[model samples]
Target: MADREALINQLAASMGAGGYAQTKYEESRYDPDTGTLYCNGQIITRNTIDLAEGFYKNMQAKCDLKTPEGRQMAAIYQVGIEGISRLRRAEK
Candidate 1:
């Protein structure tokens, strides 16, 4: 229970900074027993994380890292992937 709350707080802080509404995080719930997460009453599935990682990899493969724009985009994707990974870890 502590772990779940801590992860929710951390996620709220990080995502709040990224311009997401506070209400969204406030409504987030995690079921440690089932390892499931729900945000705004919607289930967050493993497939979502997998798709984000796939998008990041695809972007990295197609984008030129030498360009500032490419690097910025990569950073955005990386942050998202890291956030999702954190959520997964919290479930465990």
Candidate 2:
């Protein structure tokens, strides 16, 4: 697998001359007085994309959510992205 620790640097250096880079840290709260846990760092960008039409609008790509070629993109956004992935194992 690609080195995750180098994601931020690799992405940052691959941008154009005026491209901007921002590091995002996702946190989940359990309760007001209880506690919480931090997921990890993710890359957030103010970029736009054209889905169907030829028009472009400002949108958050959430690149970390998309997976390609066995890349661990989701892990990057695990901070705020949470879902019950079989919290309990199935019975035999």
Candidate 3:
């Protein structure tokens, strides 16, 4: 993996990276420590996993209701998850 990354970096450098060290574009993922998800230079999801049942229950019990923004995000993620799960079931 290290060699692969080094070779990619070298190749990219040879071709003028244009600020990309590895891939031509970059993507980010959810960071547990920050409780957020960043992708393509913008934050697409925040407090993402808290929408799950257990975590949501815990937050509700603690009276940690979210603001309007969080609620909207939660609804979106819930719908997306349901859709994906349904598709997986159909595939099986």
Candidate 4:
């Protein structure tokens, strides 16, 4: 198994660069009252972590790594999705 604490820290760092942590914690706030994480101005009540992982998998499936540009973009997307996973694990 992966070291979840480390992954969470890493994700927090990545998201913090763009003020995502501020937005999630201060502005959006996870509502224990509703058991939801407020994100992008929406109430994300369920499977936020799964959704993040699934999004990366879906993108990987769609991307064609036959070209240099495609490979580069896919790599970037992979990193982005990994950040999401870190965040989700941290939240849990």
Rank by lDDT, descending?
1, 4, 3, 2
| Ranking according to TM-score, highest score first | 1, 4, 3, 2
- How do the residues 56-84 of candidate 4 rate in per-residue lDDT, one tens digit apiece? 87887688799888898799888968866
Prediction 1 TM-score vs. true: 0.57
Candidate 4 off by > 4 Å: 1-25, 30-35
lDDT of 3 by residue, 1-92 (tens): 98998787777557643234523256654443444444464443333433454454544444423777667666655566664345334433
State each model's CA lDDT, in order. 0.65, 0.28, 0.49, 0.62
- Clash pairs (backbone) in predicted model 2: none
Models 1 onward score TM values of: 0.57, 0.17, 0.29, 0.48
lDDT of 1 by residue, 3-50 (tens): 986677678557532222343557676554544566774555556657
Residue pairs clashing in model 3 are none
Candidate 2 wrongly placed segments (more than 4 Å): 1-3, 17-22, 26-92
Task: Give one clash count per candidate, in the order shown.
Answer: 0, 0, 0, 0
Compute the lDDT for candidate 1. 0.65
Worst 10 residues of 4 by lDDT: 16-25
